[model samples]
Target: MLITIENRNYGSFKYKNSTAYVHYRNSVVAEVPIEGELVPARGKINMTTSVDLKAETMISNPNFMADVTSGSLNMTSTASLHGKVSLLKIFKFPATAFSMCNISFFILTKSIDSKCTSKIKL
Candidate 1:
């Protein structure tokens, strides 16, 4: 499966070395170092990047659904399922405050992977 994540005003978090991992079935499939994090209010991180996730190997069952095992983003840990909006919330970011962050989600069955690019603004 393939997934994409992105948003606006995503260059304002105070993380010098940001790292994130996306896992499925208790196995880490993708890992990336986001340059920075985005914070709207107090201690909230914003995920405003076009992160594309694809499955490396294809399963025999074409209707197989991916189960997100765990994900560590910007030092925060979470357990989010595939195709769930709460996955974004697991980052400890307030969805109500940064509504204009422009987060988009896309999924395509092919490879199991994820992509994240951090843009920090000081």
Candidate 2:
């Protein structure tokens, strides 16, 4: 996924603290935090990250056949952002924070002809 930020305000905005996390079935799969940056007015930036679907341990368990046969996966993400406004390039106001959360579900399927083979030599 790509996170795009655009600064449309008059003054430059400083991003103090920013973090993102991905969760699957209430389990955290990936997380990242970015360094602070000053964004000039009219400037834009993009951040990118991805989660690993193969990390689902239940998929490999025979007892969890229901989950695999269902052929669906649910995931969620939470993002936090803290920002401060710069006054005259010297003084700064108190930092304000915001958070966003999202949930998504998708179908999973396997190819019929796909196969994995291993070779060993002694």
Model 1 local distance difference test score:
0.32
Give me candidate 1's TM-score against the actual structure.
Answer: 0.30
The C-alpha stretches of model 1 lying farther than 4 A from their native spots are 1-13, 37-45, 57-122
Q: Estimate each model's TM-score.
A: 0.30, 0.54
lDDT of each: 0.32, 0.55
Superposition error at 24 for model 2 (Å)? 2.2
Candidate 1: worst 10 consecutive residues by lDDT? 95-104
- What's the residue-level lDDT of 24 in candidate 2? 56
lDDT score of residue 60 within candidate 2: 50
- Please give the RMSD to the true structure for each candidate, in Å: 13.3, 13.8
The per-prediction tally of clashing pairs is 19, 0
